[model samples]
Target: MDVIERAVSVLMHDGLVVYPTETVYGLGADAFSDEAIQKVYEAKKRPLSMPISIAVSDFEMLCAVAHVRPGMEAFIQAFLPGPVTVILPARNSVPEILTGGTGLIGIRIPSHDLALRLIERFDAPITATSANIHGLKDPQTPDECTVSRELLIDGGRLSGIPSTVVDLVERRIVRRGAEADKVEQFLSTL
Candidate 1:
């Protein structure tokens, strides 16, 4: 089977996978699977209180997991499928573990083709946390990943920066990364 198919299989079974994104490699798990989400935390040695973002295939998939507010569509059109993570109100279907009980969830529609294809085929959002121990450098390639996973979809040397995180609820840029200035400018127009 192809690498993506294997990764999808792992995700379907609530197992972890190490996959490349525009910015870095991510330790991915089914966002709705509590067992899989717990494994992601364990693998990364990440604190449970720190919520991880979820990666979606497209805007439709994003809407399925998040409550898309008015004016938010334009913001998403501006930065998503690129390197920006938007914090949105979570739908009832989202598990508390994925949101750190904050009632808000970060969503990413990555620019990388493999990442998008994987999520599309899986037909579900997957955890988008960096594939390394907490506080360590983000992994750009599969080899750099410190966390063990059932599958690794290596797309080779990802030289992009982390996605700028924008909180739509608060109407602020929570974390600046690749597209902070652009995202700020877009938000100003809203």
Candidate 2:
């Protein structure tokens, strides 16, 4: 089977996969599956209180798990498909664990080719947290990734930066990472 197909198969079995993005390697799990999400937390050694982001392949997929506000669409359209994550209100279907009981979710539409294809072909959103143990350095290559995963998509080295996180509702940048200035500029117009 092809790489993405294999990744999807792994996810179908509640398996974890490490995939490369424009920024860093990401640990992907079936977003809607609580079992898969729990596995991600266990693999990363992350706290249950910390929220995890989910990656989508397109606009429609983004809308599936989030309540994209009226003006938020323009913001998402601009920075997304790049190294940026936007916080949006989560739909009821989104498990509390993913949102960390905040009722809001961080979402990304990665620009990386393999990432996009994987999520697209998986036919659902997947967990988008970086593929490294909690409090560890972001992994830019396969060797750097330390998380447990069933499939590893080695896309060579990445930028080693995390996505800049933005909260449109409060009009603020959560964490400054890749393209922070550009995201700050875009948020200024809001």
C-alpha root-mean-square deviation, each candidate:
0.9, 0.7
Q: For each candidate in the order shown, give its overall lDDT on alpha carbons.
A: 0.91, 0.94
- Tens digit per residue, CA lDDT, model 1, 1-190: 8999999999999999998988989889999999999999999998999989999999999999999999888889888899999999999999999899999999999999999999999999999999999999988777789998998888899974788999999899998988788888888888
Superposed Cα deviation of residue 157, candidate 1 (Å): 0.7
Worst 10 residues of 2 by lDDT: 181-190
lDDT of 2 by residue, 27-106 (tens): 99999999999999999999999999999999899999999888899999888899999999999989899999999999
Clashes of 2: 0
Pairs of residues at least 3 apart in sequence or in different chains that clash in candidate 1: none
User: What are the models' TM-scores?
Assistant: 0.97, 0.98
Find the number of clashing residue pairs for candidate 1: 0
Q: What is the lDDT of residue 24 in candidate 1?
A: 89
TM accuracy, model 2: 0.98
In model 1, what lDDT does residue 50 have?
Answer: 92
